[model samples]
Target: MSLFWKESDERGHPSLGTVMRGVVLLAFLLGGWLPSSWANQVWEFVDGEGVTHIGNVPPSAATRGVIWLSRVPPASVVKGKDRGPSALQFPGYDDVKQHLEAAAVAQSLDPAFVIAVAAAESAFNVKAVSRKGALGLMQVMPATAERYGVAARPSSDGEHAAMEPKVNAQIGTRYLADLLRMFDGDKELALAAYNAGEGAVIKYGRRIPPYPETQQYVEKVMRFYRGLLR
Candidate 1:
């Protein structure tokens, strides 16, 4: 049986608190366990019947839109002691924000999602390099950069062209957009492919790989993306 409640044809309605608890219970059943992070926020999405579902975890496929419920309050409410901080911000973000935005627009992807990946991958550091040789702001690998038509330029300092903010952002966003398409717009699966390679995702039945690093990478990027949407 479906764990969620369908709206009644009559006027009867459950309390909001009851509805929320039901969603949390559903989350537990679906995930087999609830992470502590799930307690900090919840999301809402509407079903085909126009019944809204609220839960800590979004469905793998959201035909409608997912709405984040934990955004910071309006400016008028800032004087309150319980005020929450604004969306996620990274150091040096302003320097490369334009590049990320442009790349996202070109790829028909969410600017916030692109920025979140950059934040989680390199904290907006254009010179950042991973031990595995992922390069630049988005930590894109050399081969992936080439596939997107971004070539490494010969330099005396040995800095690849991918280290340039604009080139890196463009290549990274394109690669991510391709992944999203490949995975049928499933953000988690696309992100898994980003972290662990598309081969790994396909090998695992198009699910996020079992690798802890890839799992954590997806969670971190999603957290940043949600915060940015807030």
Candidate 2:
């Protein structure tokens, strides 16, 4: 699940500074650090410290902190989109399809599934970065990538080398495979771990955690996966 967990206080609460830093960093990334092309009218939501979301439709009621890039409002945006949720597109998916396939094959995983996860995670944005510091097409954290044998070298852009498309796919697919094995080949639990951290899944008795972000993530990925399969 988590590439590396943030330190918590004696009472098992994340430090206030850590939480604040994440919020500020998210604002910076969304507001400016990312490419202007990513500024599409998107609806987003943040549930706790999990990876942020950008989808065509509004998030579920269980979610909090809905973020809108436009004054149009989430409901209005969704209603205006004639193509519906399926209208969500992966902008650069074609560019990294080969890498995704290679990594999936190397890990004995379904390439469609791997691609779906990447699509859901980053929309195939090679330069994607999350508030929790997850990066690249697969959004693998640097520490977690290192744990999977991907060395953490800084790129010229200040992003970690693990963010490199090929390397990120490799580490991410490997991690997914491990999570699949850990959960006895259950893709749902594996995905829940991918979104919410493996420890969170175990803590919740190997079921998908109740976090709305994680629940929606699993559903979205599987939906993408099924679409890919067809």
Candidate 3:
């Protein structure tokens, strides 16, 4: 993920003198920015080459070097816990249970299987977005959205139809149900199609593709589902 910070003036063009003044002001501001609330919670580490870095936790690069600094207080703690599900706690567990039960009742599929699919797809992250621009909890892609009557609008305020958790889940579950039907209730084939695509799976003669990522993704999701059962 990329994060951006604005540190410059908004003017498109500034005189050289103004730019110099701005740089000086920025330097002063940065100098005074130390000993902040987060200082105590922040830590610093040195690499093998003696280059130092400051962060909330030891930098991953420190593995190549001896410990220059152990766990130190952060300058400040972000006062909140992670709002997402863990390996143990699935978000919206009750709602997922209800939805799975309803799906199983209506489609004659297994509720545990549906839950497993949800676990694999988004880990219940309602705002999950895949690299291919799939959206919402179940990661419904644009073409699939169109096939399932999900409206694709420009991503903006009031264009949140696609982001609604229930809408996304409903459409995703329905699409999965269709895939299940297409594969004649073969869960493996259906899952493979979900991860890769139905066309790819069909072209490969109903087998998991030779692509390593797709194959591993299918297997991992199945493993997670199986774990849920146990």
Candidate 4:
């Protein structure tokens, strides 16, 4: 039998709890007979359907699997130490770019606009979590997650979900597209609405909200978008 575990589904967007449980179960199964050194090398993947598989290799959904495996350090290590705090890196740059381009084109939005939003939302920090519990690189809130058909209770740390960079970018870009549509494609108004709710922008007659943070946030993202284009 192949040492690797395979889930029924091809997509690997499994629930966090499911993945954690799978990891534990795999440890138990292999721990009994395997050498300590061998046990340390076990790996697992949870499918989109929340089924967990244990193995030496990941399923096909893990196209760039070996890279992730190699990069994974001890759980005790902190991430992003080499890169400065503000400069976060995307795990799958090509995947993120592909999805962002598609979403922007479909929504008639400037691709830089979507990228800028992602930058501001989480500084491209896939593991970013807002104090209010927003999760992933997009910092998607729970209600927003439900609306987007994402998991209602995504992992609080966002590490696992964020690692699936394409998914996070797609959700974030789509939400921005919706805001743009709602604001009649006025990028500034849409950005303001994104930072400070559509209702708030509407109430303010499409002006940036009075909230200082929201106002600054809108301006900052737009400035960054402009810079990216230049």
Which candidate leads the pack in lDDT? 1
Model 1 Cα lDDT, one tens digit per residue, 1-230 = 12233321111112122122222323322322335655444433334454644454434543333332221122122344333223344456889999999999999999989988887666677777654577878888888888977778999999988889999999999999999999999999988888778888999899988775577567657766766765
Q: Tell me the TM-score of each prediction against the true structure.
A: 0.63, 0.65, 0.58, 0.54
Q: What TM-score number comes out for model 2?
A: 0.65
**Per-residue accuracy of model 3 over 1-230 as CA lDDT, tens digit each:** 21111111111111111112211222322211333554434433333443334354323432443343322232111344222112224445565566555755566677667766665565555655543567665667767777878776766564446567767767677878888899988888887787777887899898876765466456545655555555
Please report, in order, the local distance difference test score of every candidate based on alpha carbons. 0.64, 0.64, 0.53, 0.52
For 82-112, candidate 4 gives per-residue lDDT tens digits of 2111111323334356766776777677877
User: lDDT score of model 2?
Assistant: 0.64
Worst 10 residues of 3 by lDDT: 7-16
> How many clashes does each candidate structure show, in the order listed?
0, 2, 13, 1
Q: How much is the lDDT of residue 137 in candidate 4?
A: 57
Return whichever of 3 and 4 wins on TM-score. Answer: 3
Mark the regions of model 4 whose C-alpha exceeds 4 Å error after superposition: 1-95, 153-163
Model 1, residue 8: distance off in Å is 48
Report the Cα lDDT for residue 65, model 2.
Answer: 46
